[model samples]
Target chain A: MPELKTKLKEYRAIFDMKQGELAELVGVRRETIIRLEKGQYVPSLKLAMDIAAVFGTTVEELFSFE
Target chain B: MKKKNNYRNFHIITIIVVTVVMLLYFIGNIFPDNKWLTPVIIFVYLSSTTKLIGPYEKKDELTKINLGRANGITLITVIAALFVISLIGSNSDNKDIFASEVYIFTALAAILMRSLLFIVFDRTPESLGGDE
Candidate 1:
């Protein structure tokens, strides 16, 4: 199944955030940001919600399937 | 369901095979020349495989599946490696067993396979056999 990930770069651009800053915001390892951007892992529901909340968006808006 | 303890079978068969293998080695006077290592290789592989995988099988479900997968991968990798070595050695009159890829392959495969199995098993305090 193709998993559409959050446009992390876009989110970071809105927040004026660097990878390290975003990782800190999300309370995850910096490497996790790298993998998330690459679509290597589907973030857990809790993590998705957390990331979406950080960006002031719903998890549904942040993630989608093509 | 009563968890089966087939550990006894594992122990008995491995011990018997080891003893027989050792006896055969002693009887044959295995030396530097004209001494095929197939029997010895099989003996060590079987015994180690049993010892490493058996206890986990008795204890956990995931452990069994992981070990089987690791073993399957290792067996495939080893066969591939052996075939490669044979291919390379086909032209050479003198193949140095000491520098053979099989040794490195076996060591890497066994260590990774067992470590993956152990990680998958994810030992608990109870599994550690602590004082009850």
Candidate 2:
């Protein structure tokens, strides 16, 4: 599978949210968010949607196929 | 943080309990008169690993994944040990090839099976809906 580059950190910073808070909003552990930010883990479609919703953007805007 | 600490404590306690049970199981093997002890030990070992216990039964997806990985690793370790035993059996003219150890493999495989099922079913839509 192609790697997904996430703009999670950028959006998170724009929203001034902590990793744990974002994780809580997205219904996942903080480590999941941390790994996602580091590009070490891929989010499922539902999780991706949840995260994108938290940042008030679409999944395509938050993540890029690379 | 508090929840994480509790999980750590639970794991520590579980390790101690499992260690004690394993030690007692081996000790029971040396005493043929106490045949009941071994079965009880095996029961506890199987139940704990299979997540029959409350804390483990309530594990999250990440914890379930870790448990599955642990089961896979432990199954590999058990298989390696069995191979070594078989080699010893060959060298020592024991044609049985450590037949008794098959019980251990069966137990380990059962745990691995349970872990695999947990990993698979935990991600299902039903389980997610049930969580809510």
Root-mean-square deviation of each candidate, in angstroms? Answer: 14.3, 8.5
Question: Best lDDT goes to which candidate?
Answer: 2
> Interface-residue RMSD per candidate?
17.6, 12.0
In model 2 chain A, the worst 10-residue window by lDDT is A26-35
lDDT for residue B100 in candidate 2, whole number 0-100: 66
lDDT of 1 by residue, B32-112 (tens): 442556456576767565554444223223334445665777678677866777777776776774364456545554555
Best by DockQ: 2
Each prediction's whole-model lDDT (CA): 0.57, 0.62
Error of 1 at B24 (Å): 29
Segments of candidate 2 deviating more than 4 angstroms: B1-12, B23-62, B83-87, B90-132
Measured with C-alpha atoms, the lDDT of residue A65 in candidate 1 is 65
Cα error, residue A42 of model 1, in Å, equals 1.3
Each model's TM-score, in the order given? 0.37, 0.55
